[model samples]
Target: MDYLLTEEQKMLKEMVAKFAKEEIAPVAREFEEKGIFPQEIVKKLGNLGLMGVAYPPEYNGAGMDNISYMIAIEEISRYCASTGVIVSAHSSLAVDPIYRFGTEEQKKKYLPALCSGERIGCFALTEPSSGSDAGSARTTAKLIGDKWVINGTKHFITNGEEAEVCVIFAHTDPSQKTKGISAFIVEKGTEGFRVGKHEKKLGINCTSTTELILEDCAIPKENILGDLNKGFKIAMVTLDGGRLGIASQALGIARAAIEDSIKFSKEREQFDQPICQFQAIQWMLANMNTEYEASWLLTYRGSLLKDKGLPYSKEAAMAKLKASETASFCADRAIQIHGGYGYTKEFDAERYLRDAKITEIYEGTNEIMRIVISAAMLK
Candidate 1:
């Protein structure tokens, strides 16, 4: 029932906030304008151990709790969502499943490098036709002698082009439908694996999202992530954690927009007085603040459930659903408050609005989140 953060958590938050303001905020606009990946900044984040905050120390992670992980994501995202997504995709979708399901050998081989950021990792669950319907993956993996040959195309894979490894899902038995899915570790530069094309996204441009083509790519049977035909379970379980990270990202965007809007309102003038004196502007700010707080509460609750090792699927979905919509709403208002400047690249509001829209679309769309939440309630 304790609402206050522990001393350690508070310190972690301060460290992340300091890093974001000093290191990330300044270059966010430049990266967005130039469409650069900011590899150097990503390496700096890796050095700070922010890349794997929630992972165990043995794997070169900070070994912090889920709340601390969420805090780090929020702070980084507040200044730069691209970096936030890079970290989130690495931690939640890529590393978490390995930590939770990989065999000891698999952990020994992959976890350290991934956790240390020596190599980036990506998760490939969404295919050209399968996004929310993860169970409907058409990617196929067939055992051929001592190796599994995989053939499929994955779309909208975050960190796809730059990652050294990918945790991929494929259908081992199409007849079994959802139960046929299996997870595999596919390294880059494999014989038949190739990066297709990078997507020119609407926002979070610094993080690479690309298409991956697996044309008879072969990997040893030992590369299977978990038991055969059990990937559907792993993918769904991994998404619960991923959704929390996305929720934190949404919270960060909203926080930045609200703070900036308030500051701008007090300084912006109309009729020889600050906009803060106007009722309409004040009401907009008030509503944004209220919604932002509510989103944080939801996100924090989901993180708490994760730390306690409790079932968090419903909470995670709820947090993602509310926080992402709240972020989009707040960003829109921030842009509105900025008047014409908000529509231009000179102000961060335009970027914030663009970035906020993606939060509602990825990590399972808000509509999908509602389905998850409602399904849990019905049960």
Candidate 2:
């Protein structure tokens, strides 16, 4: 199997890398410090077609392949993971399911605004009680005449407060368990749909994350997404794509840490010589480079599999597992290389470390990724 990136993918990567360095790298620290969502920069990204890189051009997207999508994600993530999450969550987690399952009318009404970045989209599936056990969601959607009234709360929803549209999952028949779930398109400002307090997260501070409260929120029957009782499957399918995006994010963070650490080691004087000349520092750099390269290969391979229309669930999980762990490790090592300065916000290393930790927690935790890989092996 060929592992090389296509010329188009290479160009896409170069474009995003340049954009990240020039546009995002400069202001990442300020955003993190203020914990403010960079709406202006996000809008700029939308104009560049980074918001919907993988969707079709007919839907106001860039019409790129999965590899290009991953490249864009990695480049954006390298500079600022918060922005990466905002873009990745919208594209892979929210818009993808709608594009894949929505009726032509639904797509027409939603895809244009989302792809153009005029409107942001969010996915709401994890409830306070139902995280890894998504099948046990407490959110309910009850049919009442020609409308469905949804009542439930979704926690830790990325881009929740800022999203113009939300793809939510609810249980239509509790007795049916996972089979009872259904997806719905709920626009912001719908009566009874309230955005809750913003979460004080450990990382990805610039990405708006909050709870979604649906208190008897009503939507027309036409708003239902996909077949009735098929929302669980849709959620899982969407997560498969999201895992790939998270893997790309992890790869980017790791790459950045490695790059920074290498540069630091070359310039940092220790024992009257550059630290990079020391075997100890060189060994750490060597291990970091080796692991980062491995993680990138896994991430890119998963993207390629997705582009080929193949089953990429296991590959995506593997990529996420390896890349997230590698990112965390690389960030820790970067901090060590920088000594006391790394522990401070003066450098991006601390932010990378914080951001890398969340990658292992979100988009299916590293533990969950292991389970997926093991289950696939058994299958």
**What TM-score do all the candidates reach, one by one?**
0.98, 0.98
Cα lDDT listed for each candidate: 0.91, 0.92
Q: lDDT winner among the candidates?
A: 2
User: Any runs in candidate 2 off by more than 4 Å, and if so which?
Assistant: 1-3
Worst 10 residues of 1 by lDDT: 1-10
TM-score of 1: 0.98
| Sliding window of 10 residues with minimal summed lDDT for model 2 | 1-10
What is the per-residue lDDT of model 1 for residues 276-367, given as tens digits with 9 covering 90 to 100? 89999999999999998888999999999999999999999999999999999999999999888778887889888888999999989989
Candidate 1 residue pairs in clash (backbone atoms < 3 Å): none
Candidate 2 lDDT tens digits, 1-379: 1248787778888888999999999998899878989899889899999999999989999999988988899899999999988999999988999999999999999998999999999999998999888999999999999999999999999999899899999999899889999999999999999999789977899988899999989998999999999999999999999998998898889989999998888888979999899888888899999998899889888998988999999999999999999999999999999999899987889989999999998878788889999999998
* Model 2 CA lDDT for position 8: 79
TM-score, model 2 to reference: 0.98
